[model samples]
Target: MLSNQSEVPSLGPIQREQAWDQLQKNEFDMVVIGGGVVGAGTALDAATRGLKVALVEARDYASGTSSRSSKMFHGGLRYLEQFEFGLVREALHERELSLTRLAPHLVKPLRFLFPITHHLWERPYIAAGIFLYDRMGGAKSVPAQKHYTRAGALRLAPGLKRDSLVGGIQYYDTVVDDARHTMTVARTAAHYGAVVRTSTQVVGFLREADRVSGVRVRDVEDGRTAEVRAQVVVNATGVWTDEIQALSRVRGRFRVRSSKGVHIVVPRDRIVSDAAIILRTEKSVLFVIPWGSHWIIGTTDTDWNLDLGHPAATKADIDYILGHVNTVLVTPLTHEDIEGVYAGLRPLLAGESDETSKLSREHAVARVAPGLVAIAGGKYTTYRVMGQDAVDLAVDDIATRVASSVTERVPLVGADGYFALVNQTVSLGEQYGLHSYRIRHLLDRYGSLIGDVLSFADGTPELLAPITDAPSYLQVEAVYAAAAEGALHLDDILARRTRIAIEYAHRGVNCAEQVAALVAPILGWDAATADREVANYCARVAAEIESQQQPDDEAADALRAAAPESRPELLEPVPVSTPVQT
Candidate 1:
């Protein structure tokens, strides 16, 4: 939070209306489309540099690939196999910077053990890569990698099969709540005077002769059209990059390919391991991440041409992950063990290779048209670099009189005074009549901004109580999601704001009605409207679960698309425009 924090710049109903009013009438130096990590980072970068900006998102922030990521802030160890040393080094530097300064509260160092089956040559080969990773990150990165024997590795990870490996290596990386981090970034941008609005979709580009000027955006919350004027427009949509480019009707400089990855969450007791594991599969790498009270086992990289918003995971995909991990686990996990499953798409830069895994994770910035700049293809670790690069190109096109990228010096919303807040957790817990552990959870999620969240439950003591079905989160979280955060739909609250969807066994269906009732009054929803929201969210969850049981991608996609959409206006028609061919 800032030194003179005023409720961390609330993004409630009042703020959204004001933002849209201003966006329709005023002209900004730059307007960024897509509220993912890169887009939010870009908005912050531009706002800090004294440029007037507006950030618009069709869905919630981090609703796409950002929220459904593997949640590791790594330098892509496997990239070294491709001999892309420059990319690895750049990502490593950014990873270290984020952990130390930019988002210290959100990103925390995590240890991962890499088991080696063949002792003689395999250790040396992996050791060389670890050495380069540490060297590339300077002294600011995570602790240097360590070599471990079979006995030491077994002590660290008792769940592993005895014959699975002869030795292991432990390395450090950072982990975070991806949705929370992205939302905080957007809030930070709003605090710095950038207009931020969600559920605003860009229908087409506003052009003056051959030069692009702004965008024609549709307000999904209310059926209305508005032209947001800006000197330069930046397209930062990740998986929707090519789709946004085609809207401009300009000759695209590059192409974007979507790759699907799925993760399944199970109980923490399912895998009795102290450290996370990185298993090398024949096709790619599989990560067993240690999430709170649960384990996240994931990620299959395959080409996906299905729905971008609702990427479905097939039965085969789940079977593949379970089968591979079972080879190394003493007690293998089954489909019944899964508490939640999520699928996301990666926007890789398309080129000669048809394989999505072979596509480049490195992003490119190009001036597709006169005043339009597009950025696509980058991993979560390197988003800040991508944001800086995107802004640099946009400013060049606009020729705006602004300072250089100072985002490297700007900390996120909760980064300021976070350590001091941690020290006062016990005092705060006593003041609120709650356990220190509960206060610690609030501090980690909200940092110094915990005051804003706690203040909402001050008069209403019942609001501080833990939810009935999902005890991990407090009831006040649901209220705060609507009263402060711009969560208009129940799905937004369950899936993104609090992460109850993936953390709970019922996948948020068990608590849907309760959450809807808690947030209804704040969002001005009547009994019937609240019931509709709950019903819609329940339908979505049921469809997703059924989709996961399907045999293949086609079957899964068909089943998932049959569910009711929370934001039906998103599927409504807009002022159509000609899309440039590939």
Candidate 2:
């Protein structure tokens, strides 16, 4: 139940190679499809319980909904309005555990102000909800909500329109770096003994008379096919749930619909706020969350049936968010203030509601076939519960008595000695020749493993300095990304590993080549391969920019699709097997 932070799963070249070898060699107890948060969490859960597990992803880790979230480990305050007490309570419990034990390095308490539009009824109504939220979940790790008068609220957030609010209520929630957290979860699973592979696509399902046997997948990196046999197969492919179900040819108990949510990032100075803001919108809700040096305002939920991989944010989508947020802001933001934009799709279980936003956020799990257990629909906050449910059901089908879930007690790698490492920042700064502030940043980002990144600068002192193009990060970060983190491609390093892709003004073009060069030796990339990687990444940025200018879905989809994929072999579509009743 304890994770040794010093010892990582080490998904470097040799480790990934060994993972494939193990995949082909053993008939695992469980084969988990998808590498999103839920899939990664499921792998950790099963492996910790002594099950032999293998997890496969068609793309990089957290390339889907897992990374594209609003970044809050909130209990969904709005869910109280919908009378979803159970969901909110469960999420609050998980949020508390994540903050205090599981991932203190990644998830930290964040304060938010709920601006009151109406004077009397709104304050009392919101207060009641906040009161219930603080006490539920069987614990409270954050501060309770506090009331603020209009003057007090203005002092906290001066950018808001004077007439926008009569008062405010401040409460706390946890914020996270979604992609890094997902990767750490998968790495923790690897530490506990799970064979995890990215760039591995499941083309078909292996079947036996009335049950699922295993999966047949292809390594997108090289043209290699692998037959991985397992006692149980878990379908956790997020938005592509039904697609995976079709491969098994079994009638699914439910269907999944794609709901696209888009977010835009702007400079921190644009919105003068000491805390994050949550406001009510026409259809759903609007959040102005605090991201390090930037402020993220977004999330318009609407039906999306476009290219699943790159969900493009149209001009209209951007305008819609601007229009709503502009209502409460004194200084109306135009397109000029925006720095970056990202879009992600949420998989909602098909229901009676015509509105995608109104569809249930609760998840459902069922045995689609004797050995195939499928789970769909849920928010990021409840992924652990969803994962636990999937593994528990798979255990039921295996018909073997095993230990119940104990992930609550397992701290992720880097979380064990985080507080002590934070305390050592001053000394660490003196030793590494970095400023105390810089040392604190690295400590929070890497926790106990900060030493691993610092070690890259041992011989080459130049690596200790910040990256010239992206001064926020060290050159050693890019080098260590390839050598330590499981970053194989240039896009993997820029986009997910460090978030340089969305955080920079040039969309990573300025630093893409430099980062590639830094990682070239570790990845064994030749001159030709490194150049190709940079070109592909630049093209992707250009296409994304052009797509954002388009007014509608079809135009944007075409431009986005025209961009080169990071892996050339992935450009070719794989054929799905015809449905045959076993």
Candidate 3:
């Protein structure tokens, strides 16, 4: 079935205002309190179930942990060592679902080389685990694991030191633009009649006797307050789960601890490999995943307790990753080779183990109280399962029978007709006066809705040109970000809507003015407001760059947290009690 560009809902500024009005005038069956991947999935699930649902976010969509992921959708291969078979299987199942039916456009197959350092028992032991992994997920869309000799492995990856491994095994996984995927999920929910609004903070709970009746939300943009009534409220805030629960005046069933993960982005030429590389770290596995024109390497699993909003990556974090990755590379990478850095927190359910890496990735759902539900913990690959579980518990609070989850069958907004669009790339390029490669890039990002993005440049043909400072992106993307993708500020465009902030070495500083100007008219920003947006984005980039130079988390966080908030009211204290007047 073809997906008409007009059929996809536009979460533009007008729709955002309409959503806020709907929240005030109509009561909902469910109100979701976060806009991350899990929360977006939950909203999609509830909407597809024919539930009256509304979603609110304090910041832009995927501004937290959801966007900073390793950008992979796969069964955690390392989890096999921990014997968390069920977790791996469930994640693999979701990965297949995304690859085949749900989000074929966003999730694509990627190969990784797992280098073997020991020859004795290592190859066979690792081979057995991979064999099980390949079989566990049922039907396979990617190729099976392939064994390679030391010479063959080196042929695939000549950048690796010859002495680093005796042999290698290459397996398949998937990668995505995490922030874009999360936002698209939320957009899909919006298309199906769910109310999704960003920059709206849930300040306090509306209580009726002992049950949570609704929430009091503040517009972080203008400081305007409104009360939204719902039969049930769901808290899917990742690391801030406890903070949101406290507003209900009830103790949570399980505590969530924050585990910080960091990643660095360097040019793809730095690592000369046909397939992505996966190396073993002392705490966890490190993945050098291939990105367009770049390679993303990361993820230090460590405990973080300082600031939940802005988790900082210290200089030590970079040095640690470089130290381990350098051990295998023939041409080692220095700090100057790094292009970008990011840090995100994992909302792990606190367990008996003191080590963050030892904590379980399994999720938990609880009826915190009558008319309220909370879901936390889980890998990014299994977000759909987490959403389904959370909604199943929440249906018990509803007055009527709700339909089972249809999300497994429901493809995201842009998934349908994507393959057909791929076959027409050359024709599309000719029609749009662009190259086939640029057309394919748009198709990959927007799928059947590529026209929606291209339409922005209809009257203004200049919008079709590449961004000045960040040439990888088109100028129209910045315009589409504000016009239909719900980007309210310059930071949203630079950081999430487009990945210019992380993909470029200047970290979006040099192009701040151009992007701000491109988006100003769409966002209704005056010259002064546009200038403020550019300045704020520049300061944010400066702070992040400085923070990455700090020696430790404490110092890094202080530097990052001191940077200006695009939405200033997010820093305001959430009221403990519902207002008597509202």
Candidate 4:
């Protein structure tokens, strides 16, 4: 229950307690597990269609694979090589909807050059694929692809070595802050009256004979447990899909395999490219993307069988990426040039192919049990469609004729007045006594909710000052995260809300104390608790740094998993055995 001033119910500490109480006292039509993009999208779709829905997550929203993606919203270009046209077209349509209508403020069009190595057959082959890509179903907004000779390509990206390519083709895609977009979707669900809570783990399923009727959940913060009754339950967990399906004591229609993708961040000046570059790799493709003040070079796709919560990026992973990307760069990036490293797992639908890269990005939906529906294996771009599909199946269990999904016509919370606010950036800066540049940055992150974020600084203007160590972000951003964005731990603020962890060299260790102090009062943390939070965050950063130096996944997992858990009550998961299928 936030103050009456907010357009939606702000998911602060007050509202969290209310949601927990309501979960026990009332029965919902649907309860969605997992707070990743698809889970949040499902909740939003159900709520908008006039259903009482609840969403619960084991950790913070997007804490898993959703937060750690390559941060793009494009059709998988290489999938065209596999002749997956329907998947590509669906993704492109979703990308178009996001860019023009859904979240114009957060999603921005970006340019990328696909370098041509062999002179003869490469150009036409690549050109035809991109030609189909640009003219796909809903790609009316972005510019068409253009061919560039070797000299022209060098002019656009001078950092590329002359010997690497004979020519290139520059094309358009889109980029986003994945964590923020996912959080915004959750908030929009709350706006439409869905109950959403984080740091709440589903321990078991409640059953009526043969079907799931509800869930038993534990508050990770305090170790308290409650049972939530729902007519239908949706398992939207990405990597944890199988674990949850096991709890239902039912046979899942499909299995999910985790594929690890690693990315490294370096200073923007490390490459002198005006646009991003894409190169073909032996296994797949590598992207050198532009991310604000840094260039994000990534993605090694391999099988990972270690900790699903924290996917560790080993020294071998870093070396693999640098070796591939360095082939095209004028100055090869080394270990010292790296500022940040992150790894995420993709929950691909398991198939006969052993190669994780060869698995399909196409998602599947199944009515695993009478009252439980499971959806898994889709790219980030098509999350909304996956949600609609999941809910469409769950509606059969509800008995009532539910309204069709209205999420496509529904704008997210901050999207309405965003363009108007962009036009008023100068005036907003003058009124708030800040620079126009800073105002633009706030606008991009918070959109029309910028006023709600700055409202915390009404009497205390010093809160508007930049963070001492991470000067790129203001101090008030941290406060807003704790007060309104459902940030229960220091890692939630530093890693997801503001991205200071991945953008800075110290990886949020330097600013941990100051941030903890700022949110202490809002979260009702005493002096001892604040100090403990700071200590844990610093230790976590140290563990990650040490883990990255390891030679392989096994070594990295040992170091990273040994670090302290922000939610200490959440111990090792005990496997729940599935009953024999009827």
lDDT of 3 at 25: 96
My TM-score estimates for the predictions, one after another, are: 0.97, 0.97, 0.98, 0.98
Please provide the root mean square deviation of candidate 3 (C-alpha atoms, Å). 2.5
Candidate rank order under lDDT: 4, 3, 1, 2
Q: List runs of model 3 lying over 4 Å from the truth.
A: 1-5, 572-582
Please report how far candidate 2 places residue 331 from its true position, in Å.
1.8
Any runs in candidate 2 off by more than 4 Å, and if so which?
1-3, 571-582
Q: Please provide, for model 4 over 150-172, each residue's C-alpha lDDT reduced to its tens digit, 9 standing for 90 to 100.
A: 99999999999999999999899
- Give the Å error, residue 449, model 3: 0.8
The Cα local distance difference test for each model comes to 0.88, 0.87, 0.91, 0.91
Q: Kindly provide the TM-score of model 3 when superposed on the true structure, using C-alpha atoms.
A: 0.98
Worst 10 residues of 3 by lDDT: 573-582
- Root-mean-square deviation of candidate 4: 1.6
Summarize candidate 3's per-residue lDDT along 63-173 as a digit string, tens digits.
999999999998999999999999999999999999989999899899889999998899999999999999997229999999999999999999999999999999999
Q: CA shift at 50, candidate 3, in angstroms?
A: 0.3
Runs with alpha carbons beyond 4 Å of true place in candidate 4: 1-6, 574-582
TM-score of 1: 0.97
Which lDDT value does model 3 have at 345? 98
